[model samples]
Target: VRDVSEGEACPTESGFIADQDRETIVKSSMLPHDSAPRVTSPAADEGSMQHNISELTALCTSLQRKYSELQAKFQAQEEEIVKLKDRVKVLEDREGVAAKQSRDDAPIKGGVSMQGRQLLKESVMTQRRLQGF
Candidate 1:
């Protein structure tokens, strides 16, 4: 290898190499305009967000009240149904008792003690005694 000279440029096997002092600088340019980008007011935006949240909260509250009312109505209807079922059971029991009483009394019709029949016999005896007198 020969000693490099300061006045001469160095040549590589793949041709001349790029100089370190000379570099290709990358730069970009933007268009200048009068108006700037849009900017929203913080106060107005916060007020709108608050109003929307309040509306949603009111809707939720109303829905909660409606749900409570519907649940109460359902419970009342269930209680009413239970009461009606109990009444029906009582009525059926009364009908069974009446049926049993009638069945038991059916065979004792001739052996019945009737006050009207006793009074009729007493009246006939009194009439016979009066006719004999």
Candidate 2:
């Protein structure tokens, strides 16, 4: 067994510290007293590393899929928002035209046209002259 310092990680044959050794070193450091370093065969370490790598890869794939789905949903919502804004603009334009048309067709006074006002003025003047008042 190789001698490793307390809290020091042992590097594998590949020159990288194994995940198990890292975890063991971290756990041993958390203890109140120093503990003997646990050793395992190279084959066992390799197997453990492969398993950890597989789990990490699976987790990465799942996260990527979720990110893609969220991105698609975001894009769809953006498109919907644009469509709604355009629809609102069109409706506002139509409302403005309709309001202008209504104003152009509306009477000047309360339910009375210019010609109606002129006839009413003439009738009042003629009645006043006939009554001598």
Candidate 3:
């Protein structure tokens, strides 16, 4: 590449210089006028990049907070599930006790066979009917 200050001809790949570059010279033929490419300062580019980084950091922090909230909610739900299971176990134990008590309270003489218990029940029922109760 030829420097503009050197005044040396800029080399063209096809050996024929395009007229677009020649038309850009205003007062000094060595410098381009309106057609010069706009240059952005390094500081401005750095500031933009820093802004993007700050936005990303804020987004990451927000996501982390949401994740923590969800994790806490999930833990609470699990604890609730455990508590419900314990309650169910207690209810099942109470039901089992009530069922066992009912069985023990059933009308039947001790040491009686199943057939003797049935005959005793029928006799009692017949006596009840005769007494009109």
lDDT of 2: 0.88
Tens digit of lDDT per residue, candidate 3, span 15-116?
454555455544367665687788889999999999999999999999999999999999999999999999999999999999997676664567565677
Better of 2 and 3 by TM-score: 2
Worst 10 residues of 3 by lDDT: 18-27
- Can you write out model 1's per-residue Cα lDDT over 5-76, one digit (the tens) per residue? 755546674443343223322122243454888777999999999999999999999999999999999999
> Count of backbone clashes for each model?
0, 0, 0
Q: Which stretches of candidate 2 lie over 4 Å from their true place?
A: 1-37, 107-133
Model 1 is weakest, by summed lDDT over 10 consecutive residues, at 20-29
Residues 34-130 of candidate 2: C-alpha lDDT, one tens digit per residue: 4777789999999999999999999999999999999999999999999999999999999999999777755777967567788899999999999
TM-scores of all predicted structures: 0.49, 0.54, 0.52
Error of 1 at 49 (Å): 1.6
The lDDT per prediction is: 0.78, 0.88, 0.84
State the TM-score for model 3: 0.52
Scored against the true structure, residue 8 in model 2 reaches a CA lDDT of: 62
- Residue 117 error, candidate 2, Å: 10
